[model samples]
Target: MAIGLFYVILLGCVLLNVCFYFYFSKVCFSNPTTYTKNVTPVSVIVCAKNEEENLKRLVPQLLSQDHPNFEIILINDASTDDTRFVIEEYMAQHPQIKMVDVVNNETFWGNKKYALTLGIKKAVNDHLVFIDADCEPASNQWLSLLSSPLKNDTTIVLGYSGYHKAKNSLLNALIRFETVLAAVQYLGYAMRGNPYMGVGRNLAYTSKQFYDVSGFMSHMKVMGGDDDLFVNEAATGNNTAVVIDPEAFTMSKPKQEWNKWWIQKKRHVQTSKLYKTKHKLSLGLFFTSQIFFFIATILGFLFGLQWEAILSLVLIRYVIVWIVMGKGLSRFRESELIPFFPLLELLLVFLQAGLFISNITHKPSRWK
Candidate 1:
């Protein structure tokens, strides 16, 4: 009986959070707004790691951004492949682009974080936009759309990132679902005036803001922190802005397999330990509710609880998850996945549980 009561409480908390998330999604993207136009000097940073093929395509697209006073800075982080050669060729062709070469030395800091720090140090702009080598801006207006927010004390710019539509496998669908959730959670928080994280694939912030927060100095030892951790420190009530203009979107490839996806997710979660206390508490509570609810479902079935009551709890839970996720899907333009929400949500709950349990064990996971 106590366990059943506990599950009821868990369900209630989770339902409240779902409602809050729905509210956030509505308020955040209601206006579909962009920042004011300001000629802030902008630098786009690309961290290339064995991205030989992608650079051939993505670099040129990045170089073609229509911003008047922006330069492209590509950091070659210990690439043993043709990534350097491709970059060198591009450098010779484009004078506005600068390249920094780094070795495979994880001596004092994480690889991606160190590469980003190096790029920022060499950047000569008031605003810095970071993107991966495998990603390309959706349109030429990308820079303007991303940088427009700096006019008003909006120090941090959170932009949208999606996967290329070329892949249509189940894995790709799962990645799409994951991207929608990220857009919902982080961008939703920004709407509620409490931005906590940003994605490295397409995020922007002022150079002064980066230095002001010490530029990932504290979380350097961890394998991740280039994006989310940095945002946790820099973004506050009035200092952050989220850009959802379709033209401002960036696209990258989805992971090819479940194992690789798990590792990528684990690497991402490694930085969660560095999140601010409030953010940590919110995420902990959010995750705890889902975990306990799942446990309750299993226990209720095992103990021969009244079938109608068990069905009632399960149906209510699904309805709440659907509504929250539906708002996210509609906001992020991922309505096609609405039909597959049941399977994806179930997979996500299990996946999230694995991540939490693995995190508890504190063992290092292999990077994909």
Candidate 2:
């Protein structure tokens, strides 16, 4: 009976993994090829705190975007550093650039969200595009490509944001792989008209949609969710769109220290609890199946029970994952991580499980 149960469990895991691969293959493979030429006026919003160096470097790239009718709004949120000077210098030369400063206040809301609200209130355009101070656009067409869907009635546009490649660090490779995996799910689901969450690093939507959803009021107390949680509540099949165009991508610096990355990831996972029930179930099932697959495979090998079947099942799942991941990486222009996918996949599964447990036990402090 025990042996029979093991077989059933292993088969279930394999099936679940295949189902996930199919979803990725169907949605990501059939990417939108036709892009509209609708160039609408966009208000690009950036919220920064103590990121003086990054603001000086990346904000220029944003200012130099080739889009004709757009403005860049930078919110210097109580920075003890030279963030204000950096913005002022840029604003002096560029008429389209605007700046808002948020003084340090003991408020109940997260600082990032509060800063974003202030920026949105000052925005003069109907469409808003958001990116972090640390992120740089991949090309001049970044704004054009990101905001094109909005011309066609897409209220929410989700774009890919990748990490800059680092030399000689397994951690960097893992970070890039994890990012690609996440893009596969969020983008794929959006393509399938079941949009859930989006990364704030490179996302766009209408100001009307923001006000319609009350602008992060539901998850206001949480440290994060300025992006994902708002989209979770507001996105729908008819209104949300996904953009994987290489020209539309943005690159951000990855966390170098393990502890820093852990804290960042833990804060991110805290907002998952607020996701809709469907999202919760879908993500929970995927993670549970992944954990079971790894644990059961090891136990089956240790006890020398059905090694042949276990190995076969593992190989089948890996093949599907590899093929799907290859397509997703190609689409997102992260094909460099393809060779490291197998190892990174195994590492991320364990790391994600640990992060989930840590998030449940400890609440993350409210900071940017």
Candidate 3:
């Protein structure tokens, strides 16, 4: 009976890798990467609480965007630091830079959504692009490339945001690996016409779509989902698109310490609790199959049960993963992680599972 169940699990993994969960991701894999750019005027919004240092480096890039008619709206989210001063200095120098100063109140003390809404109201252009204060555009064409895909039925455009590579740090590789895997899933799903979430660090949508969904009022009080949760509520198959260009990417610093990164991931997992049920099931199914694949492979080897079958199944899964997802990794500059895929997949699975359990037991606190 145990042997039978193990074979069934291995077969399940192969089927998922095939991704025919409604042709899950095969189309995205087969289609070549392409983007359609519309040179529409846009408002670039950034909300900062205590990101003064990052703002210093990011503002110059914003000022230099290759787009012809773009405005920068910087929201000083009641920072007790030099963030407001930095914004004011830039506003003084450039008419294109606008500021939305937010004061913390009892109702929405650290609510980034609230601050972002005010910035959105301040925006002169109907089309809006959002990036975190710490994120730097990959090139002068970043804004153009990121916003280009948001045309016709495409109201929301999702782009990749990656971390700066650092050497000799296991945490760095783990962070990048996890990031690339996530991009592949979400972007692939979007291409499949079922985008579920997007990174706030490199996302774009029009004011019309924002108002169409009534903005973030549904999940306003929740922490750390201003980007994803909003996308969850607003984005749909016909109205969403993705960009895979390297020049369209955004880069930010990764958390170096394990504890810090853990805390951050813990907070991120909280927002998923509110994801639509179908999306939750789809994402959960893929994740569970991955965990099972790794665990089942080890069990087959250690207990010496059906080694030949296990080896064949493993090869099948790996080959499919490489062929289906390798282009995405190369686009994101993470092809180096392809060799360590098995190990990294195992670590991320166990780590995120533990994180999900911990959050259930004790919720993570809020941050600015």
User: What are the models' TM-scores?
Assistant: 0.91, 0.97, 0.95
Please say which candidate is ahead in lDDT: 1 or 2.
2
lDDT of 1: 0.80
The best candidate in terms of lDDT = 2
What global local distance difference test value does model 2 have? 0.88
> Could you give the candidate ranking by lDDT, starting with the highest?
2, 3, 1
Candidate 1 local lDDT, 18-58, one digit each (tens): 66566466533476784566577889899988889988888
> What TM-score does model 2 achieve against the real structure?
0.97
Candidate 2 residues lying further than 4 Å off, grouped into runs, are none
Give per-residue CA lDDT, model 2, range 100-212, as digits (tens).
99886777544688889999999999999999999999998898889888965679999989999898998888888889889899888877788889999999999999999
Stretches of model 1 off by over 4 angstroms after superposition: 1-7, 10-14, 27-29, 104-106, 165-168, 365-368
State the RMSD for candidate 2: 1.3
Model 3 residue 177 CA deviation in Å: 0.6
Residue-by-residue lDDT tens digits, candidate 3, 73-117 = 999999999999999999999999999999989998888999999
Candidate 2 lDDT for residue 216: 82
